[model samples]
Each structure stands twice: as structure tokens, then as C-alpha cells.
Target: MAPSVLIVGAGPAGLILAIILRQNGIAVRIIDKEPTYRPGSRGSGIQPRTLELYDILGVLPAIREVGEFVPPMARYEPGKIEPTSTARLGEWVDPTPDVPYSNALSLSQDEHEEILRTHLQTLSCSVELGSELRKFEHFSDRVVAHIFKTDSDGNEVEETTTFGWLVGTDGAHSVVRKQLGLSFLGETRTEQQIALGDIIVEEGVKLNLWHMWSVPPKLIALRSGGATSKKFMFAYTGRPEHIADKTITRDEFIQDFYAITGRHDVKFGPTSWLSNYRPNLRMVDKMRDGRVLIAGDAAHCHSPTGGQGLNSSVQDAANLGWKLALVQKGLAAPALLDSYGEERLRVIAQMLQLTTDLFHKTFASLHSADKSDDSGWKRGGDLAMLGVNYCGSSIIQEEPDAVAGSAYMEAEGGRVQAGYRAPDAPGLIHSGTPTTLFTIFNTASHTVLLFGGDLEAVGKFPQGAVRVVEVLPQGHSVGALAGSALVAEDREGHAYTGYKLQSDGFTVVMVRPDGVVGAVAHDTEGVERYFQKIFI
Candidate 1:
């Protein structure tokens, strides 16, 4: 099929973009340079915010089935039977009605990719393995990609196709980024090197926890929280000079394992995969070049210290996919695509600084307790990614009432504001069904929420592209409105409290497809004006 979008690199970002675009009735073709899906548990941390996106995308059920909470770390000294130090990986916070997922979970990166692929398959799209994008160029209105695939006799057959848009979800050394003549400026850590792998071990080794040995110049961490078939994820790094940037042999691994753990009964078994490399911190200055764009590692890369790489990339896809869909449907102008870079680049720059800071702090904390804060590590609420917002975006609009007391609109505690993440409120009965804001937020479409608005005003909504929801305040005439088929009762006042709707005027909050509030208006006239800037 001739696709509207040709996505390069079928990793998390590419797969997610494809899935979302396909779900929204846009044709997409996703191609990967890798011959097969990569194995081993690399980039295994799924942040709370990414988990929420997974729920909205209809993949949380599968992800939850295979995912596990981050187990506390048991730090040990060399040749010692007992642990010398202990630090919980992260504190577990109970789920709130507003923030359903409040902590990070671990799933092997490969497992995470598999889950994305599974859902993509359900959308009648699958990754084209062993297919590589060799070259491409953008014309006046479309992008043409040159792809090479192996034929029946192992001969390379080249196919060239044109797409309305081209996206590179490729990696740090993305061909798309290179082709666009963009620069990825960052530094490489020659001081850090490690041999990481997934290996089977004896039953003496326990599961559901981390085994860590942090001694200056050398470190070894073994975690089994999301292990498949009882195989532990092993990362061995010590003495940058001694660490090899290439795969190590079994004998070499065994010697290093014993040297660190000082345990004889727990033996190492067969290895499934091995890789050695020093990570780099890099990001593209711009995420788009006309019709060609990039997301995920193709846009930015950093040390995996804070586990933000994957989550950030998935968000990149989530942000770009819907904008591309809207543009493709002719509902929005192509200029809407420009905001993808502006909004995402700001977050990426912040992430690079955050991850780099954490990378240094993690190494610094090895010898002494962190005096900066009670938490030895910096994996706190910020790391949950719930705080990441696009409040600075050009498309986000807020009226005077929403930001009356502040110099500018800001994210208040669980309050819904323009450009902030739409807060979730439970105990809302819609169509005789009990639901939260998230239930209606599952679709890849604009949602206009009316918190105590006139019932007849629902006819003013932009048809087909928006979901109109009328939320009635508690004890404020509990009856369905003729303007909306989906009317809700805020029985517990969570919606009223979250929206600050005690005022007399109707509070109209427009949420973008990616969950960021697009606009806040006082009435139907304001709603139409806000959407006129959005839909063509």
C-alpha cells in the first residue's frame, strides 16, 4: 500500500506512531534497519507517565501482565557475605484518583517493544524487519524513501516509495538526522564502559530484587524484576580502562562475576545476549526538516541513568503522531507539525540535563550518602514524568479567568489548565456507566469538556474531530443534557475540585489528542474561536 507516512526504524517510537496513525485511519508503513527485533533487557524502566500513555493507547493491560515494580537495591562490598549498604530503588506511592500511575515499573526493553509490536499487529500493521532505509529526499510536498530488502536468493532488492511525510524514529546515529544535515551536539563518556547481558543463573540467586556491587572504578548490578525464564539482567562495569567495549566471553564474565559477588554456590549459566558500549548525550537542534522529521533516539540520546530515554521517546511519538494525523485528515494545517519540535525539544533539553546530573550523582553516591536530600537517589516525582508539560507551546491557549491570579498559567495541584496535562477525576457517571476522565481520553481525538456549561451549547462543538463531554457539578440538577449523549455527574466533587469550577461561569477545557489541554474558554463563543485556530 502507498502510505501517507513512511516511518524509519521500527523501535518503540516508530511502532507507536504507526499504531496511532493507523488507529486514526491514516496509512503508514514502518521500516527498520535491524534484521530482527533486538533481544536482551536494555532500557527496561517504564515511567509512570509513559504507563498512563500506554493505558490511553490500549496497551496497558498487556504491559501490566508482564511488568514488575522496581525492586529495592541491595548494595554489597567485594568478597563480603552480607550487604554493606541498602537503598530502595524508588519509594512506592499509592495510586490517586487524579494520578492513576504514581511510580515507575520495569519491563525488559525488548519486552516493551514486543508489546508495542503486538498492538501494531492488531491495527493491521507490522514492522518490516531486515528492511533498511538507504536514502531519501523530500520534494515539493512528499518524501521519497529508498529501502533495501533481501530477496529470496539473498540478493538486495531496492524499492523506492513516496510518502506525504517521513519520520525517523531511528537511533542516535540516525540516517534520517544525517540526511537532513542536522547536528547532534553532545559529549561521549569515555570514562564509563560496561558489558551488559541477560544470562541464566543457578536457582540460588533470588528473583524480584537487585544485586549491586558499587566500588570506586568498578561496578556490577544484577536485576531480575522483569526477567524472562529466570534470566537476570547483568551489567558489569569497572575501571574504564579494564572494561571492554565489545562482547565478553563466558570465562571472562564468570571471572568478573565471582570477583565482585564473592559467592561460589550461585553459578552463572548460559548467556542469551551480550553488548558493551559507552553511552553518549546528544540531541538534534531541530526535530523536523520540512516534510521529514525524527523522534525518539533519532531526536535525542543520553546515558540510561535516569531511565527517561524510552519514556521520552514514546512521548515524542505520542506528540507527533496525532499532529501528523490531523494534518493528514485536512482538519489542521501543516504548520501544526512545527510545534512537535518546539514542544518536544524543550523537554529533551531538560531531560539531557536531568539524566546527566543523575549519571554524575549515581557515581558520586557510591562512596558516600547524598546529603542533598533524604532520597539517596534523585528518582522522585519528577522522574515519574508527570511533571513534564507543554505549557509553553504556541497552540495552547488560556483565557483570563483560568490564569487570573498568576502572571502566567501554571500547573496547579491536579488542576486542569491550558497546556497542562488534563487531570483525571473519578466517580463520574456517564451514560449510566461509572468512568474517569481517562476513559473518555482513550481516543486519538480532541475532547472538549464542559464543567457546568449550558446544555444547548454542545451543538457549537467542532463536529467529528472533537468529543463533547458535559460535566455537571455535584447537586447542580442531576439530569442528562440534550446537547450531549455523554453527560457525567461529578458525585464526589473531584471534577469540581480539580477544575476549580465553583465559580458562576461555565468552564470549558479543550484537551488535545495527546492529553495536553489545548484551550480554556468561558463560553461557546470562546470555544469556537479557540478551535478555529486549530481546525481548518
Candidate 2:
């Protein structure tokens, strides 16, 4: 049987979107043009917000076991083995009840994709490798896709299939986007180029630190711990055309590395992967075109300076998965899918600007006379992505006369407002069992958190669409609650503190499947009003 959804590209974005859709019982098929899984340490930084999403998807445990915190950076002079400055990449923040994973994690991109593919297997779905999307025709109700692949007998095969929808998670050179004719408007930074790859380093080189060298003609940086402890991810600026064009031999590449770093004592084994990276600050004009949609690198591509590319791409898939599931299941109107583009375009725009600014700051500091300027290295604040929101999205709702502030920026004075990330609250008692907000939230349904509300008076919304959880203050009786709603007593007051519930009145916080606070209503009627915009 043909799948209901066809996802082109089996990268992190495509794999994650398939997982979310499959979890919601949607039929999906993911394909990649490559014959085998790609290898490299591309976009290796995982932010805190991404960790929260992974927890919801049940992949956090494996990621936590294999991933390590971002290592501190060690700067060195041209030929000096020691006697240099060392500092952390970003200030470390201790975890709190609201933000359990506050620090960024370092794991290779290939390993990351492998973990995601492994998780997808448990769901009875897997990427169809060696299959490529040749062309696709989009109609109002369905899409016809032409696929090209080699059969088991080594003969080439061409097949035609149909799907309810098509999504492109293919990288920057997206055939789907080009076929859709969406304007990819942005500039290419010809001046900024670097050679990135994964290589096995010789013994005697420390594997716990990220080493940086400001050699005369080029800047070389090596990040330790790739697919193995012996491997390192290396990046060198001042790209030569020969290297970019892949005309440089392996010996010449090694010679250039030794020349730039002046470290002949450290030797490197055969490289596993190599590519020339030129920053492209570009974004598509729209994310959707009728029955077809584009996401990740297809919709937007930016510099890798702040490590926002992969994280943003993962979140984009998360945001679209639930919405598309609803539409495919007939649980909501087709217009609900439109919100995917609406919500993500804003966040992607802000991210492109943020990353571009960081890119310029980093290169400026490196070229300037002041070698001690570490301000560009500092990452936190908005870079953590905990502050990214969708308050301006048309689907989000708040009380009348409420000011709908900007999206992706921290609220004034740390206030949790509508359309912000639903903060996690620990130390809750659920009918004599310990629970937390994150444990209750899943990728399948909306989690309606009622704080200090009368269970009987709360009007009925769509039961199939939401899970009602009534939260009471500490010391309150969490005894058998009325109706199907689960009762949770805030044993440590973290629920109220994390959400900033200063008022003692009943408050309803509707958390979307993607973990964004869709609405903060004062009454049950307001909650239904918000649902009206989503459900048919």
C-alpha cells in the first residue's frame, strides 16, 4: 500500500518528522538519494530545547548516554605544545526543575542520524536508501511522485506512487523546492569558506579539549571525540580552490594541515569524510505550496557559526509533524497544515539573523589585532533556544486585551507568556505516584494543564485531541479526581513557580504537541475558543 505521506531526504529532519508522524499513527515513507548513510560531523551541537523534544520522543536516554557536554576550547600558538589559554565554549548552567537539560551536547552528525534511524526502526518504519525522488506532481488532494532506484537484480527501476502530502527535508540543493519555484532569496558569502571533515588523529593528542590554532595563513580548529575517541572533527578557514574542488590529494591536504598548525608531532590517519563549506544566508519565501511543503535546509539555510542549523531543522520537523498528522487523520481542517509554515517561517527568519550576526562577529574577532576578544565565542541567552516562541502565530491564543508580544525573544522579566516553550515542572504527585509535566506531555496529543481550576466547571473540549491534567498547589488533596482528568499536586511548588502563576485564580495552559504553549486561557470557554481555530 502506498504511504499517506512521502518525505524526501533521510537526514535528521526527515527521520525525525517520520518518527513523529508514525507515533501519531500516520503512514509515512522516507527516502534518500544516497546509497548508504552519509558520514561527517556536520552540525554537531544539540541545544537544550532539542533535548526537551527528544525526551518527549523517548530518544533522550540513548542520546544522554552517548553524547557529551560541549568541551572547553584550548587556544595555542603556532608551534607551542603548551602554555596557552583555555576556556569553556559557553558558560555552564546547572540544571533546574524547569530546565533539566540546560547545557548543549556534542555528538557527531552521523552518530546522531544513526540514533534517530535506530529509533525509527522500533516504530516499524525505516528510510528507503538508494531511492531518489525524480519528479513530483502536486494536486489539490494528493501528489504523484516518480522514484528512481536500482532493483535487487542490479537493474534500474522507475516507479510511480501517490501520497496525500509531500514534504522536502532535502538539503540546500532541494529538488522539491526548485520544482515548487519558491524564491530562495539571500546572498552567498564567497569570502567565507572552510574545509570540514572527520579524521582519525594519532596518539598523544588530548581527546578532551577542542583545540584552536591561529597559524599565520589559516585558522585551524579540531574538535575531539568523533565516531570514536581516536577520531577528531577538523575545520580550517582560508579555503583554497583546489581543496574546495576536491583536486587536492590526501597528502597535500595533510601537508596543508601541518603547514597551518605547525604541529608535526601530531599525525592524522585517512580521513573518513571531507567537504568545503561556504555559508549561505538564504530562506525560502514560503514554506508551503498547495499539497507540497518544504522544511529544514530546503526552506532555509544559514551559517553554521552558532550551531543553530541542525537544531532548527529538528524543531521544524517537530512543529510540522503533529499538524500534518491531524490533517491526514481528518481530526482537523486542512487549514491546520498552513500553521506549520506560518509558525516556522518566523522562527527561521530570526535564527538566520542571529546566526549571521554571530558568523560576522567570529570572523571579525579572528581577523582583528585583538586575539583575546572572546565575546564572539560566548553562547547563551537566545542561542540556547529556550527563549524561542511563536506568540505571533495566528493559531496561538491569549485572553482578550492581552498584549501578544514578539516571538523568539524572552518575555519581559522572565514571564512565561502564551506561545513560549512550555516549561517543565518537576515534583508533582499523580495519585500517589511521582510525575512531571514533561512525563505527561507526549508527541501524540495536546496536554491541557489546569492550575487551580474546578474540575466540574471546566467545559468539555475535544477529548481525543487533548489530555487534561489538573495541577493543584502543594499540600492539596490529589485524591481520586472527578471525570477523566488526572490530578497532580505540586509537592514542591515548582509547577506554580516555573509557570509564574502569581494569580490564585483558575488558569488553563494548553501545550501543543510540539511543546509550545498554544494558549493561556482564563476560563474553559477561552480554551474551547482556541481549539475552535484548530479542530474542524
Best candidate, TM-score-wise? 2
Candidate 1 C-alpha lDDT tens digits along 43-155: 88999888888877889999999898887776666776666665666777998778788888888888889989989999888899889998998986988889999976889
C-alpha lDDT (0 to 100) for residue 359 of candidate 1: 81
Q: Pairing residues by index, what is the TM-score of model 2?
A: 0.96
lDDT of 2 by residue, 137-184 (tens): 999989999999987787789989999999999989999999998999
- The true-versus-predicted C-alpha distance at residue 245 of model 2, in Å, is 4.6
Backbone clashes for every candidate come to: 2, 0
User: On a 0 to 100 scale, what is the lDDT of residue 245 in model 1?
Assistant: 64
TM-score of each: 0.93, 0.96
Candidate 2 ranges with C-alpha deviation above 4 Å: 226-228, 240-249, 399-406, 455-459, 502-504
